[model samples]
Target: MQVDYEVIIVGGGPVGMMLAAELALARVRVCVLERLMETTPYSRALTLHPRTLEILDMRGLKAKLLDRGKPITTGHFAALDTRLDFSVLDSSSNYTLIIPQHETEKVVEEWAKSLGVEIRREEEVVAVHQDQHGVEVVAVGPNGNAVLTALYVVGADGAASIVRKQAGIPFIGKNSTFTAMQGDVVLKNPPESGVPSYFNEQGLVMIVPLPKGMHRVVLIDPERMAVPKEEPVSLEELRASLLRILGDDLGISDPFWMTRFGNATLQAQRYREGRIFLAGDAAHIHFPAGGQGMNVGLQEAINLGWKLAAQLKGWAPDWLLDSYHTERFPINTALLTNTQVQSLLFGSSEFSPSVIALRNMLSNLLQIPEANYRLATQISAFNVQYEPDREMEPHVLNGRRFTELHLRLENDVCQNAYELFHSGSFLLLHLGSDERLYDVIDWSKYKHVHVVRASLAKGAPDWHDVHTALIRPDGYVAWAISQSESNPMEAIRKGIIHWCGHV
Candidate 1:
């Protein structure tokens, strides 16, 4: 059998599903293929970042997800009963919502299906080829072999992606020497308060609370490690290990699922190869430290989805495709580097008494302003900033973040500044001191564009203090002007011309 679409995503995981949802919402036909018939029950990422929560909120999915996962309000760095509370930063996002990966997958799949996406399960791609015009993919389904041709192909498969391999993109980086055992187990006595605890002993042990009286536990060792198996983990062995490691802290009894795994870190040299591309685990993989794996993958899907829509609609330039690599590859590289450094810190041995003392001291010192700032930089996604090719206008709002301001329309509907971002249309917001600035823009000239009056006094400072700001469909501030009486139309015109590639 043969089929064709605007874009074909090569994995049905959370990232791929979300991408499909985005594309479908944008009226782009897409297909998603998966090797597994169903979602796995494992709890890979027990924590979701705040930025990710906000992103999902934009799609109206965050409230439902908040109900599924227990929020981890506080965190601790402990060793041998000595503990340091890092909950100060927890105020930013009181919880790292602990929901199973399967639940997340189901939510995304349901949402994507409602948006009209074609998802094919039990399909494995055997071969992939790409040319200037499009990509041809061959996969083996249950009934028979099937072929798909599409303008764009995305590989969200996994760390060992067949599509990535077929694309010949070099997977670079080193695998760690140490291994760890991780599993979701039901305990006899679960903690009343939901908070993640880290134990730094002979090896690192982490306890994360899950829904329905289960705890996602991890035990790590440098010399001895448990081997991975396809079947369910042994309940008896897990109980014994917990008894020895955790002692009386949290009683361990019933086991739901367990898995043993080694550590490895690798990144793709290029995310795009002609018409073939990679996202999520296919593009990058690293140690599961900091719980950044899934979050990074989901963000990649969101970033690429809209860009693909633009290109398919004939509004994006040729170089727009290359921007995916330019913007994401650096972020992936930084994440891998930070995770490696953190692993070294968390994986310290007791033999190094000096190192252990220094670590504890540093952990305590992390409560200070400077140390807190450094840790916050890693924990929060605010540290990431993409550098565009051309220089930004020299102004205060130039290259700064887009704030979520409140806007009131003539119809008396009060909403967020982002409402102007709907329909992937460019929005020019006039918040200048003089209302005359609004008269400058002839709204009738642009049919697809949105113009809004944003008053700072109405709500919190969502965007920076700029008189006039032009926002891209992807929610980026393309051009901004400070309070200026000078004819601002020239700046707006230049911004539109530059971003739309009309010049």
Candidate 2:
């Protein structure tokens, strides 16, 4: 069968929609098939970390989310007393946004639609078969069962991912040994201090104010810790847990949404299988610790989207597509480990004195500047560093996340560096305008790469003395050439071939 599109994404949640929008932004023809006719009103995942905001800024979507979300300068680690101070992180968006999942999804879905993505709602993909040529998908929709083909298929579906199962990619991890309760409700007597958190032998309980005079309550109770995640949570159940743990539910009432979740962590053996790939929860899942579940998935969408588009457009280097798995797998592994650790600290191991003591020590340690910054980077996902290309001249900036840089263009007009990535293309930023740059490489042949001749408008210690650098569409530095290099222009030529060319 003829390929219906370059890529067909199965699942149209925030992750799927973000990926589709990225592809469409790069001029890749893509479609999304989702089982739900509308976005979920339940806001299970409500936090967007800093790195997530940075990537969204790249696509000009950050401003939209900013308008909808409330920003907080701190995040939790095991519901510790001293939280991770995101304000210390060196980013414009060095904080988590307290926006509900429904709001996030709506912002992304509108983005996907604005970019011309064909979204087929109420379409459930039952079977996905991929061969050497392409992938065939069978889905049931309102019209009837239908078959469609695409050069590649991505499963952004959550925990019970049909695409991942059909691809036969084993999801390996441990089953849940304990669970916790979460709810968004109206609190007649809310926390006086705005956001109140308490951790003790009784159990951990935190309450944060939400929009529209509502409050989000999350708690772990020793008595109900072993309840199966499938068991539904009720308002009465929350009241009992609060009275048992916090001695008062802060007058908890009128739950807009409530659910029981477990620490059953898992990750796909590999993110890709032949012509099929996995993303978001389809690739990995963990307990809702540090409010990082949704952020990690959104970041993955940014990482995978451009690489797939590059391959489809024929300018992607041979190894580019496979690098998606190589780069993301280990990161998810670390994510699962951190979540497990957080779960253990949340009294999953035992709601006793020992865990409480350990958590107290860690929380106190986090008050120290050095310790706080390290955990802040990890939870905010600012610590991610892609392995650099060894063949290129070694520079400290290589493989590092390209944080915001102010550049003075050839015309001497200064602008923030992120504006270059609006179209989701490789950015060959030539900091020093050596006229020999164009003579060394045929820039026209690499039309997909956006070459900018500019110098640093602001004094950046790490970027000082850099002749040039190549940044991947996902905002990671592909490679950088040091000013110490004897032949910088020749290095730029090789870097372009190593990244921007299909060969």
Candidate 3:
């Protein structure tokens, strides 16, 4: 049978599902193909950064995710028995959120389904062809061969992406040199105190807290010392190794899932190829260091989703579609580099005495207020900022990470600034004492933008405490003029146009 959609997304993992949801919410017809018949039971990624939380909050899934996961207020970096808690970071989001990747995917899938997106499970995409008009995808489903045609194609299909391959895009990078095994196991004496811990030895032994008193562990050790290659890794053998390293106190019991992976860092040379584009792991793969793999992928989906929708809706300028590659490619490349750095710290055991001492010193330094805050910002991913130099003067906040704030509008009532951003339109926030900037914006001509005003009766003015800010449809700050601005909108406009184009 033949089907048609505004976009056909390959891969139904978290990233793919997120793209599906975004497309459906934009009222764009979408079809997502998944090779798996059911969701994976493994807790692949359990840490959700504050930035990712903010993204989910936009979809109204934050509360539910928090309910399903535990909040880790502290993280400790240790050497065998000695440890240093890096949780004292003076930052807005001081903790790591531990929500299983599967649960996260469930929420996104439900949201996509609610938007009436078609999800085809057990359907394997075999080939992709893009012509001048659109893209044609062939897949094998349960009954027989099926074809799906769409104006655009998005590959969120993980590290080995069929769409990217069929589109002749190059995935450039090195395969993982470090070998590690990850699994969810029952520990006899799991820590019941603050945040879980990482017991770094020759290789890393991490214990990450999961909901319902469960925990996930990733053990990275020398390949030779690891158990012999076997179809199903012997739980008893893994338990023995744990006893040898982390000690017998763990009392490892039932293991829900066990898998081994090597540290392979790879990224697509280009994210967009003609009418087909790549997002998430389909575009890049890196070490699961700092819990950034999943979060980075999610951000890619968010970055691409709105742009694709805008282009399909005929609201985006010609160059806007290509901007997806320009903005995100470098970002993903940086993430890959960061992941590689983290692996060296946690995955390798060839630490000289000097190196060990240096690590300890760095750990202590990270405890300092400024260092902790910086680390927190890096790990939590709240430091993402877009270029702010391209839009018109008096531009609404553009090309930056969106900030959360509470505001009292012209009406006596007050509400959260993000609430106003639900429309996914370009917002023109007129801060107090800066209402005159509104004159520069042609609100009547731009139906896609919203103009509003706000004063402090609601919250403070830190970046996280921004009282009034304009958010782009993709949940980024288009331009933010402080209530005490000295006509700073012009400067902000310079940055906004860099991303929003000349619109």
Candidate 4:
């Protein structure tokens, strides 16, 4: 069985392209098969949460993204009046970047192409067959039918994934309960004030400003809740919904794009089957509450890409590849749960008095700093914590994202911690005066790990007490130790072997 590529990714959305770029960064041969000949014009998702921005920063894409989108310091939870204050988050990028999904795809596509990823557009995957050695993918394109073989195949296609269906993976979840409409339209008489959100006895409506003069309007009309998804969304329908929700229609016209969606929530029973795996909408779908769909998919790609590349590269631990599902499934489950709750909170055509009281109570609670911070962290994904391997006693910082800190390298250059991860490799940062820490490990053996001896700058109180730490490529602290550790060298060796594998 000769493999044409190390990996073949079905669908060239943000997740697929992100994984492809990551594999390419590791010099793995990868290709993306997409059914669409070009990028989508419609912007389905319009915001990148805080954690997502931090991930992009690790790869040096954050600046470019910031240039294209506006950064809003505050976000909302279930459209509540109390704002989730992103500015209070403990990361360099603590704000949500309001960039369109289309622009996001374009940026990731360009980055993937630059990394030598072979993206074959207009190629639709029809059938997938896998054996112990490799997986064979049958795709139909403009030219004809072709079979491509790869060591591994990942399905990033949307909800109606052909790869997932052909693989016989059960997508277990509920169907749409209520339907809603969304449109990007030019408003002749736009509301002169804040983002308008109305929830009453009739339905829910929200109007947000877009990049151009267009406004994005979302409406859930109980009367039209039974509207079939296949039916086209007309300007008149949007206008009528607006009039019903608001006193006036706001003069919406010349719609750029319009579509209908539902609150159907689903998650794949498993993320991987043999050599074929799932990601993005192929793995899970829920109501677009909190604007988390694309962000979660992108984060999933980040989690899977490095592990898959490590397996192909032959340095991966036996449990490394499987940990992808072990680590991400719980997060996806939580995401589904929260979105379902939000659907119940906002998807209704009318809010009962009890529901209004609940909303008011919850909003008041969010006004409390701790309560707001907790929910904000969850929504922004800043609170994601993976379980550390039980081989050693866990440090509090272990399995958590390494807080961004400034470091003064031996060469006297000062930089933030994220700059060290731009190369997508493990960083062994020694934050003490003991240069002997560098001699504890033989550098020649671990080619993917870089060792840096530096001292913490003046104001990193979170990391000031930490003498040494090993940070993973994904920007999480694999292991850390305070100044009081008895056997620092031995502990460091154990941590390295546990995380990076042995020489």
Q: Which candidate leads the pack in TM-score?
A: 2
Among these predicted structures, which one has the highest lDDT? 2
**Local accuracy of candidate 1 as per-residue lDDT tens digits, 328-443:** 89888988887776566666234255656666776768667666555554554545555632644566444433555566655557776655654546677777445554455455
lDDT tens readout by residue for model 2, 370-440: 99999999999999999988878778998999989999999999999998999898898998878888787
Residue pairs in candidate 2 whose N, alpha carbon or C atoms collide under 3 angstroms: none
Worst 10 residues of 4 by lDDT: 347-356
User: How well is each residue in 302-329 modelled by candidate 3, as lDDT tens digits?
Assistant: 8888888888777676777887888888
| TM-score, prediction 1 | 0.88
TM-score of 2: 0.98
lDDT of 4 by residue, 1-503 (tens): 67899999999999999999988988889999999999989999998999999988999999989888888887777877787999999887998888899999999999999999999999999999998999999999999998999999999998999989988899999988888899999988887855667776677887778887788998888778889777889999999888887768888999999999888899999999999999999999999988899999999998898889889988888888998899999999999999988888784545677777777788899999999999899999998999975776667888887778888888898988888888788899888778677677787878788888888775764575787888888888888887788888888888888778776
- Between prediction 1 and prediction 4, the one with superior TM-score is 4
Of models 2 and 4, which has the larger TM-score? Answer: 2
- Relative to the true structure, candidate 3 has a C-alpha RMSD (angstroms) of 3.9
Off by over 4 Å in 3: 1-3, 75-94, 195-202, 223-231, 347-352, 391-398, 432-447, 458-469, 481-503
Instruction: Evaluate model 1: give its lDDT.
Output: 0.69
Report the error of model 3 at residue 254, Å: 1.1
| TM-score per candidate, chains pooled | 0.88, 0.98, 0.88, 0.97
Weakest ten-residue segment in model 2 by summed lDDT = 193-202
The lDDT of model 3 is: 0.72
